[model samples]
Target chain A: MTAVESSVATLDPEEARRLRRERLERIGSWVLPLAIMVLAIWLWDRICVWNEIPQYILPRPGVVLQTLYNDAALLFGSLLVTLRITFLGLLLAVVGGVGLAVLFAQSKWVEMSFFPFAIVLQVTPIVAIFPLINIYVDNQTAKLLLCAWIVAFFPILSNTTLGLNSVDRNLRDLFRLNGATRWQELWHLRLPAAMPYFLGGLKIAGGLSLIGAVVAEFVAGASGQSSGLASRIIEAGYRLNAPRLFAALILISLAGIVIFLVLSLVSHLILRRWHESALKQER
Target chain B: MVPSTTVPGMEGSGKPLLSLRAVGKTFSNGVTALSNVDMTIREGDFLSLLGPSGCGKSTALRIIAGLTAPTTGTLDWSRKPGEESSVGFVFQEPTLLPWASVFDNVWLPLRLKGVSRSDAAPAVSQLLERVHLSGFENAVPRELSGGMKMRVSIARALVTKPRVLLMDEPFAALDEITRFKLNNDLLELWQDERFTVVFVTHSVFESVFLSNRIVVMAARPGRVFQEVEVDAPYPRDEAFRTSPAYAALCRQASDVLVSAINSTHGAAA
Candidate 1:
């Protein structure tokens, strides 16, 4: 083929190097935060008097680690409960969000009619409604769903709406020229093009669902007979068990971080092939 | 005695295949893009629409391709009996789907007709080979160079064996050497495929090198200003581009363009 025919074979090395440099810069910037975290953990252990502070009032990180080791069964059991609630809540949010997005995208009237309510739901604090929901819903899991849906629904709805609407004019025309039916256009073109945006929204919503689960559990004041990490945390705080309280807090943070990282990793894995945004440095 | 079964534009004999009737286009903002344009696009002919920027050359080609309906007038296609497909279009930009493989992009037209990949593989592969992208089937559009992408676009246009191929400045973006080489390959493809080509370009020499007829246009109420016949033989090469006939035609086209520009200036003044 002539050079015109083979034009797509060339790559810009400069652009590739710039992409590499950007990734390295990102890695470089994270080092300071890592260093500070390590230093702070070391100092907290060294300065705090482990024996002087009562066992219930203030346990050292070492002590919390020991407590974590000792109460692995209880901790793991509570963790499973919280995780179930989070997972179910997130799944429900995705279903609700995608359904609403399709409705809104298909018709401007529906988007206008239902959009204000979504905004209102988004703006209204989840913490305030937790008690009301908890009272109405005897099932703790149902209350957890309500809270998580409130937190997670907006991103999915907003992102999907944007994604569906952001189709290229040329691409739309191409579909038209090809005699593609409306359903074909939607399924083949709009959905695939919107995948990156949907994944982004999903990543944000994953963490939000976890937060919702924890907050709902907190307000419910669930008893340890069938309780979660949030109940244990509240119980520890009320009884002045400082190290255990910190230990519970650490568990919650770890859960949030793990959910966040997992979703981010999933988004990258799904989008890294075709999407420019998800592309990483070769190194 | 002739069989009379040969398609008008497909054989080496030159003849008009399509005609435009006082076609005009005006944007909603009241900008008249094309005004009272008249042209006959002949078969086995390389008709170049040559003009400066915003001359409505691209708009005219789009109108013919049925991509956009003209604000006024009708396009008449003198179809042969029982011909199923008629027109193919290549835009100024490559416009290949970045996500699709080279082979898939070329096979898009056939696929749209409900043809299976296996069924259309021979035609797709042959078209690819014609465009000189022999072994690059699995390569994505982004992986290819700019010129290579345009070739894929060309192959995509030709895959269905169109009667009329409309191109809007297909090589205007490339460097001089690349453009020159593409110009040569395009001529060869046209000779082989035997399809009528309406190529839009702004370069005077380019129009002279490639076209059987050059339709010169002027912007600001875009309209046909002049038409020049090249009267050159097929399989035109670099040698043909450097010949006296080519230089003379280029000068004639350039003069017509200059006069068109002067007339517009005079009217504006």
Candidate 2:
């Protein structure tokens, strides 16, 4: 406890307490969520048992999980279909959103003319637009992909535009003084500055893309090899197969979570060295 | 701080690198930032444009750097072909790329001119050493203290070995101790490199300490009010700072600045 002991090798009691508290917090972050999930599942099982609820009305977690294990081939194949749409939608949104945002940054007139159309696409519900998409697109997968892309497109476009436009004024002047071409300025300054915002938009779009795919599948109401989890849920609902419905629902949620975690990891890796948001991690 | 070595001051004997003849700038928003300003910047001269707020001292620096064009009159250049684009600028803030390391920041100008890092390393490192930032090359601007960031900024400016260094209040945001140390270091660098400096600062004492010649400007359609010669020997140090001669020059610049604010003197002076 003496001040003389604070030379280099050891921490004082206060420092030790802080370190212990930090470690506890890190552990609790993951453990608490998992514990709560287990507790919730137990409570759910107990309620079903206590009431003698029929499995058809509200299947127990065990029933749903068992259904998942037994029908792994069907469920996994459907999950891959939904995941394909999510990833492809996300990819198209990134390419189209960033490409348009760059054009917007370059020419104000182009942005002024087209930005309102983008807003229109964002504001209109995908449900309402499906009729038009249904008429125009013959392919079911194309319709689902288009719907997903539309949902995920807005955030990337807006955030990247904001980042590109918000360049430091003095740095812009410095670039001009050096007689930098517009291409060089965009490559060296705007794009790099816009990276954090683009990554932020990417995180939001990742989750949204999955949601869009699920919603599109629900609306399609098609049943087949590539109809995805939502359609499988629909098929289970008409037949009153609650376990299969719950299993499909759980698969969709898991897929969304995995997408979010992967996108967040990418963002962290890209920004950890230089960005203000990432620097706070202190790793 | 380095010891003051004997220096044969340029004493305005160097040829005119560029001249601003009746230059004026009116912003697109209908603000006349500068009016009929005339200046002859000579090679190797330490010149300060001294003024109050809204005096367009910064506009003048921007004009020299060609960041902004003059609305009226001419900026004639006499520099040879290879040196035409050789102007280094430092802003009021460090204005560094937050993502770049100190070394990469210093290598920016050369990079713009198509020099690879391997090609630019010796210049960047030597300048970093001169700025006392050799050990901090890998640190980002956020990791650095204020003075260290400014040192990196200065190193970036000098890395290209510019013929004219245009600094707009580069040390105004810094603390007194850092300012003094930077001032002493800047004097040594100017003496060693002999680059023309058109420094924009409002501080009377700072102007007297660093500049061989000071141009006092008046605001409200900013124009030159008066010019004062420090006429001090080169390699100015802390000893010169405390000397009566330095005090006299400061007092003289302060008087010109006072009249400039009061607008009591005509532009002819």
Candidate 3:
């Protein structure tokens, strides 16, 4: 505290003012959002009270919280199922995306011959392909996982391909000058350069994978013990259990938020020291 | 120093470290980047290829560095039997890997040659020390200022201890003060290491300041125009930069460069 005080005291008036602004910004970034959320939640409760809405139609936030507590085992288990598919799908996408991107980086013929297929797959909606998957894949879990992978794969493939192609010209020449082999060039030059791009895709893919899982389960309509939160939401909707439906939805959104945060953290940890995207914000 | 009295074109140094014999390059687009760029670089010679922008000095350097192939003629290197074909090249920009640390960047050549990081540490550290980047081994390229990045690049280039060090206007982007400081440090390293240098640039003052021999090149087919020797003794400093002898040499080189530029301009017109 003394060290900070001494530094502040040493700063000029303008510098002190700037320092104060920085402190305020740091605190406000967290506190402001929380305050607004509290206000919004209060407003929601007031509307529920004023409308005198019944529990089935528009359950109060308190009732939803109680239902979440009451249905913890069911809701949490369903979230785990959804999260498992999302993660497995993302893992497959990374391996396939990066592997194929490397192939594309190496040979124009390979890329030219098959890149259109990837484009077509990306452009074709997963919903449109659901019927096809259902026909071929008898396993419900595999079907949902495949749908998630398809949704998540394109961003990783395209971003990684772009990054691989964008290797610095001079650095490439340097690698060539040093007699680096094809494998060495890919491992040392292309992969590290593609990391930021790959991570960017990962962040987008994280959320998309969750959405894919939920949407796929909804489309599949396979209800059972192993069914994900999407099935629970559908079941609660059928029973007119608005609080339970809200609880299931809240679980899915929370799971999505956790996945995004984890992916973002992974990106930050990998690139914090070097990448421009992860560098300390001067502003 | 090769006594500053050696003839520009006369043969029989027996071991001209590298000699370009009628080198020419024509791109697929039909732009003749270089033609008949004949020159011989001797051991420990600070030779500069000086001219205007389109003069193909960089192309000639690249050809010598074996980055680009010459469509016509040969680059002959008279290496000793045990010597590997090696040359260090510095690009116009500080092309250190943005993702790699200063030490790792310097360790690259050794790493490419199959040396492990721990094994190459001694050489990397020694070169980093030579370039005054000793404490900055862990810093990435983005963390460095432009001049410092250029310094790291020089260290990386020299880490392999190549027989020839080829620089393509390595300090062109730096401010004048930083450029001068780097010039001094480079000369110090040259004096210490005694490696042959082939520096390419358009600035006559810089060329004259650094090189004992400056080969002025012409554009529009980029060929050698003239060769001017500095005839100045080493241990050159600010005293030398302000001296009448240096002024005369700069004037002579500048006149040659202006003539080369005008000739290219006339051809283009």
Candidate 4:
């Protein structure tokens, strides 16, 4: 037999080609929605620019592009500031969320005690709580941290709690019969099994962190001298510099997209090898 | 189980390797899965716990393997005064860890006992060969066929080298051809290993073919209905399966099963 033929003896080329065609078609299906979005954005940008609507009301894509270029240094500095808080808040959320989830999973009393409060936090708007948190913490940075934490904590806590509690009874018994200590069971079985759920929570928390950072920045701008993309947008709007505001908005959108992609990549890389949901193809 | 002829309790004057003293199991949910199940398993004896579903066959096997605590019985095991291991269990489902490769799955019991992978590798590899699964050390459970998965489970059970092997309907889920092949392979493996086997099965023919003795059980507050002794010779083959003696034993076993069914619900047609 030919080398290629022998290598794929169990695999039929015609069938594989058919499957590839189907899979490629499925990937190609994303093209239409992307095209529609691009077309709509471009058309809206053109119409706004043509209408000679006040620049402050709605900046044209070209004007926004110019503003981004002109204010590159200041914009990037603010971008870094926003990213720092977003990432730090995310780190804190994961640590607090997963740690609490482990505790809650281990005890019904802990879950009952804390889960309602977590739900209450989740439901309470971060914007409404920002001023209060600012008062309690007594620092601009601390207030921002508290606000962002409120926004980002719930998803990770809920997802991880579910993950930790949802271990297979058979697997638990297997560990018990094998003479594994409770600590080993948790470190090995509970942790690994909870990973997919934790990653799932992380993906949600990732996006929420960016939103939290932006919102906290907005509230911070409303209160004091600290300024970020939200403040820049507000300042540009007040000054009738629509291009700069558009630039800030564009940056915020980019941040959200970046967080989505980065967390998605992390989740996929960690879980695709074993988990069915993240897996793109069968081995 | 190596060197084949060393019967555990009956071997060379050692105490009985494993014994069940009036074993009974009643679930907290009011299900009496087994009751007053008295059994003495000698070394190298092929004993089948034969019964229908809910007959406590699996329950009995589980109790022997120490996977489940009997509600009203004590297990007597003499581990040669120094042997730490007592019994090994092969579950009905292949129960191979989906994430671990075949070698790793088989190495679990040994690994749990503080044996390094390298130290356990030779023993695990030898076990793979014993189960006719060489060169498949790296294959995962998802990569294996049903029969192959069951073989891996069997291999995992045998890796610890326990005196008694408790198999709970290990081949019940396999296709007829695969089941027959595995049955013969199991007997061959048993011959080589010489561990006392407590095999659970629902098939009359299978029990007749494999076991030195078959304990038939009745369901619903499960209890032993009767015991049948097979006087068949060793090294039984396909010819033996088709033999008049085997058919007669099967018929006798079936009669006992029907009688038990009749005693229970008058459903033994």
Candidate 5:
């Protein structure tokens, strides 16, 4: 038996071939998507050049890139403002959502009484609320943060509630058998069980928070140093600076992509070792 | 091997550790899980509640562990006051905390009892070794196979050194080979620890091999139908698994379980 095992373990030719194929497949997964994106952009640039499109109507990709490079200081500074609002909104949403979720998990009555308000906040358009918020609030940053918070709050609350409630029944029984107090059970079992769901909700909220920040900024339309990327887009539209408009739009989309990737990476890093959703498929 | 007998509560010469008299459980949905179940679990005895699905064996175990209160019965624990906390339960599934390591999982009960990690480490390590999982302290539940996870669950249950251990079909999900191995290891553990165990299983061979006393239960408002004692001596090993006495006891228990299952069908018909 030992002789047969040693022979099999000595790096067989079939094993080498399989390993090479696996490596190629791993690289191809990422490279293929990037290649397709580059081809699409190239096609867009060619269509504009061939049609003799004016800069105001449809700027060439090079024009848009040049506009981005020239306006880097202004656009990038606005991006920082937008990103600050996005991150602040996301952080506040997490705290409020998880705090309320724990309260709801602790008492069904509290959930029944207050969960409707959350739904109302979710369904009511942030644009509609912004007028009321703008009229009432004195601070501009606070108004934008509130709008972003409203948009990003519900998924975290609902998903976390579901997660806290979805604990295994047998595990609960075991906890009860072991004489675990209410706080102990919540701290030890429910919180950890809710982490994956919380992270999932975090991914959705991350994108929404950025949207909220941009949309709120657009609604505000406050000019000067405090204006964000959305305000820049509005300014460019009014001036008919098409390339600048495209540049600002590109920055916003890039910001959204970065937020999504970062949140996904965080979720994967935390859950990779244990969670079924994050674990790699064996075959 | 000791001879077979029909002694219900007189097998071992000691006061009953726990007694359930006329115990019955009815859920809020009006489903009767158990009815008029009477049993006495003595200290240091390996007991198996043998039945078909929905036979209320698990319900009985739950009631014994005080996890679920019986709707219409009383349970008397022979132990003095404050000793009721020394009860351990193993569920059908492993019911492990997937996020915790094997060591942390085993340390849970002690941790809940306010034992610090450093204080509980030795007991946790000792229990893991007894379950043949000494090297798997830091391994998470997701990394272990079904049998190995069950071993960790058993280790967690035994870590507290409970006076009574209630197991509800702990090995029913395992394959035949794993089940046999766990059964043997469990008996060895029981012999070493001398903790009273109330094991629930549907396998007659398993019940006969691991339990000295088996309570046959019937379904459709499940209740105990009969009691069969295998009068088998302790230190039962693989040799006992192949012995004539083991075969006879298994045949007896199987006949009893078959009749119990048939009676449920007959009543339904």
Candidate 6:
């Protein structure tokens, strides 16, 4: 019996088949999307070349790439500026959102009085508010940061509040039975349980923060040393430099994707060991 | 058959650790969960509050732990005022913190008492070993089975070495084999520690096998209906479980529970 088991274990056909399938699926996930993207780009270039499209109207993919390469210094500098705004706005939003959420969890009256204001901020379009903000705020960077922070703050606040309130009643009773102080309960029980919800909100806020930064920049139309990728897009549009415009757009889209990916990775790393959402479902 | 008794502080010859005098609870929504609950918990006694659902067994346990306040009664504690920390509670569910490792979950009560992790590690380790979870110290609650999670919960409750341990249907979610194993282990722990235990359960056989005295309760303004004494010798093993005495005690308790449950139905009708 032992000899038979050992021989079967060495050449397990079912195990081998499953491993091969898993490997193929893993490779196909990224490889397939990449191949499709390359093919689409090639087709786009072919169509532009075949039709003799004007560079001002519809530049070829190669021209767009060339424009990106030639203006790397200026474009990359603007990219850094845009990314800085995105990060800074997201940081401020997290601080404000989580801090307010803790206060809301502590007192109902505070939440009732201030939550409607936060809702008004979220629902009121940033574009509509930009002219008013620009009129009052002379510092272009601070105005952009405020707009971005407003856009990103609500999800974190709502999600964190829900997470804090959704604690298991049994666990809360246990904490009370142990004679835990209010601060201790909040710090130990509420905070750890709210982490996954906070991280989920962070991932969403990452994209919104970038959008907020770019939209605010476009509205401001600021040019010169402080200009971001959005401003580059506007400048390229005025000159009818379609390739450069495309390049700037691509850089903004890529930055948004990177932010989303980084936030997701952070969430996964923190929750992988314990949370139900992070656990792999077995058939 | 054991006679039904209503007089408080009548059972158990042991010295009283805590006495509940006319305890009652009425929620804000006007639901009376418990009413005129009078009982005396004696030191080193394994007392089971066996009742049907909605009999306020859990509420009674919670009130004892000071997690909930009684509406109309006094809970007089025999222990010193500063010894309020010497009470541990286990809920119906395992209630282990999913984020923490088994060691950390067991270390929580001690940590709350201002003991550092390093100082609490020895007690946590000893309790984990007692619960047969020695090698699973670093394992998260998610990694454990239902029974194992309950074991961790038990370990955490015992880590503080509380004089009174209140458990509310702690093994209700587990399978029969696991529940039986846990019951035996709990008895062993009780034998060794001699802590005053107020166990709440709905199972007659379980109460019969584990407790020296079982308090049968009724619902609809929950109150005590009867008290049954097992009068069985301790160091009970598989032989005791299979004995005629165990079966007889279970039969008596089952009869009391049935009548208690039926009385509520009769009153409603």
| DockQ of each candidate relative to the true complex | 0.28, 0.67, 0.74, 0.34, 0.77, 0.78
Q: What fraction of the native interface does candidate 6 get right in terms of contacts?
A: 0.76
Query: How close is every model to the real structure, measured as TM-score?
Result: 0.86, 0.93, 0.94, 0.88, 0.93, 0.94
* The TM-score obtained for chain B of candidate 1 when compared with the true chain B: 0.92
Model with the higher TM-score, candidate 2 or 3: 3
Question: Which of candidates 2 and 6 is the stronger one according to TM-score?
Answer: 6
Off by over 4 Å in 6: A1-23, A222-226, B1-13
Summarize candidate 6's per-residue lDDT along B149-255 as a digit string, tens digits.
99999889988888889999989889999999999999998888778789999999999998888999999989988888777788778899999989988899999
Q: B136-224 in candidate 2: lDDT tens per residue?
A: 98998999999999888888888878889999999999999999999999888888888889999989999999988888999988888
Q: Candidate 4, after superposition: displacement of residue A224 in Å?
A: 2.9
The C-alpha lDDT values of all candidates are 0.82, 0.88, 0.88, 0.81, 0.90, 0.89
What lDDT tens digits, residue by residue, belong to model 6 across residues A1-283? 9998897799679987988899999999999999999999999989898998899999998989999999999999999999999999999999998998999999889889999999999999999998899889889889999999999999999999889888999889888888899999998899999999999999999999999999999998753425899999999999999999999999999999999999999999999999989999876
Model 6 misses residue B175 by how many Å?
0.4
Candidate 2, which segments miss by more than 4 Å at Cα? A1-24, A223-225, A281-283, B1-8, B81-85, B264-269
Candidate 5 residue A63 C-alpha distance from true site, Å: 2.2
For candidate 1, write residues A1-283 as lDDT tens digits. 6785556346477766787888888897898789899898887776667447566765667999987888788877888888888888889888998889888878899999999999999998998877687668877678787898899988988998889888887667666666767677787677777788888899889989989888888877655433788888888788787776787788888998998899888888877666788766554
On a 0 to 100 scale, what is the lDDT of residue B262 in model 3? 83
TM-score for chain A as predicted in candidate 5 = 0.90
True contacts kept of each: 0.18, 0.61, 0.70, 0.18, 0.79, 0.76
Q: What lDDT does model 4 reach?
A: 0.81
Q: Poorest 10 consecutive residues of model 3 chain B by lDDT? A: B6-15
Q: What C-alpha lDDT, on a 0 to 100 scale, does residue B100 get in candidate 4? A: 72
